[model samples]
Target: MTVENTAEATEVGETTEVTDTTEVPAPVEDAQIERALEAILMVADEPMSVVTLATAVGAPVKRVRAALAAIVADFDGEGGGVRRGFELREVGGGWRIYVREEFDHVVADYVLQQNPTKLSQAALETLAVIAYKQPISRGAIASIRAVNVDSVVRTLLGRGLITELFTDSETGAINYGTTDLLLSQLGINSIDELPKISPLLADGADGFEGDVR
Candidate 1:
């Protein structure tokens, strides 16, 4: 009786093992992987690395990289369809979708027609400060404006109105300056064309406050 009971217990264990194996998830299919990659790449604001993309899609890095290459080729008409207006490109050490160079003017015109670019009152004030005191740091701009300018700086950078000219060697702070786009918008030839701030100030202060220099 003891030997018969032991054999029955062993048989039960083997059955349980087979049931567990059947519960395991199957490997992701190539078509499903490509779809997942497309969904992610569509909404991503910046270039995504293969490792990052893999983690998001729960796929292997090698497979994610392969899918990205395939997607890029598909956008380029490698699959025999007409080429898309945008293309997936690897830039700045990662991959992102960008408008094709030939369609830049069309996209620009569409964007302009969709909505006229307008600056807020705060943005106008911050722009004025940068115009007069160019090559200035964000901290200095904040000090002059008495408010944080992080988002404002990003907005200006996005609008192509300001740029990071260089980093300060001593403080490691980025110095910003108005871009040529701003100059053109302002109908000025150079930064020198900006009007003197002292006369515009209600207090007529000739010098900047603090060590913001």
Candidate 2:
């Protein structure tokens, strides 16, 4: 009887242990979610919506949204891994990852730290014309400047300051325009923010007259 009672007690203890193990699993941690989110962001070329990312990761939208918020907060926190190193920004109505403004100098230094190449005065003048009259053709650019600008335009294209926006439908002439990177470098929000040229020219008439060829 003593041995039978001991066996029954052991069985009861085993049943209790099994019952405890059958309970629901723990919730996913924020750190785990952040790692997954970073992977998705790194692979995406454009800003990814929360719903889209949730579908890709097989996680619920609510959870993904919470995770994104937490990740942003984590990056924004003092002495955070991303603080002053990188930035998370929302552009074109979506989120994107980019290096912070403060670190741009460092990155530029590392990538393009070579001796600075100076643009000739003629090249500067050509660039100014193209930037002011974008969607303009090379012929138009040359016409306005009354000089050949093929080399200048090519240099701008090589520097990534300008890009071919489109070709004229009828003539197939390439139309050139300034890039977003150019705007960023110029510290202007848009081309419209460029200094008004007519007034500037008017203001500098005496100087222009002094240097007229």
Candidate 3:
């Protein structure tokens, strides 16, 4: 009977140990949460919703919101710190990090200093196609170039040289076109002023015979 009592006590102690281990969770650190938010916001192209950020960091929405407020305060020099050149802003029902409006020209000048030359070869070719046959689809440009133009198109769009004019009704393909920025760069008032393609492509390959205009 003493042996039986000892065995039961041991079992109860083991169960208690297991219960103690299972009841505790690893502590969530504030610095860890802040770092996670920084990493995610750095690469996010669009504004992130609080719920999305909470889901990403495995924290509750309220906690994530509080963290965001804390981060903004930290960046804004509210706690007797240096004011950051960038700021966290809430727009379109979401949150994103943006350069402060006062520093717009500073950033733009730095970017221009980094690349002060003409457009890249791929960008030039893509711009040429858009300048001539614009309101054209990516697939059409790819067919003409005999290579994929997705990245090139994106570059042109980013540079403000091209824009999405419209989407096809049946195929739903986005049609791209040259922007006024391109016209200004080309020193032409309108796309109609572009040089004739046939003369320029007299010695070109098989797929280069069409008039882009």
Error of 3 at 73 (Å): 1.4
Which candidate would rank higher by lDDT, 2 or 3? Answer: 3
Better of 1 and 3 by TM-score: 1
Q: Write out the backbone clash pairs for model 2.
A: none
TM-score of 1: 0.55
- Candidate with top TM-score is 1
Residue-by-residue lDDT tens digits, candidate 2, 116-162: 58767987887787787777888888887888988888677656577
lDDT digits (tens) for residues 1-213 of candidate 3: 111212223564563322212233443565688778878887775568898898888788898898898889988989799999999977555677877868755655565456567788978887777777777988988988888888888666556677667656566576888876667768999888987776566464345535444
Which regions of candidate 3 fall more than 4 Å away from where they truly are? 1-28, 120-213
How do the candidates rank by TM-score, highest first? 1, 3, 2
What's the distance in Å from true for residue 188, model 2? 1.4
Clashes of 2: 0
Error of 3 at 51 (Å): 1.7
Note the residue pairs that clash in candidate 3: none
TM-score of every model versus the real structure: 0.55, 0.42, 0.50
Give lDDT tens digits, candidate 1, residues 37-115: 8888887755677888887777899999889888888899986778999999875456777778787556545644554
The Cα local distance difference test for each model comes to 0.73, 0.67, 0.73
Name model 2 segments beyond 4 Å from true. 1-115, 203-213
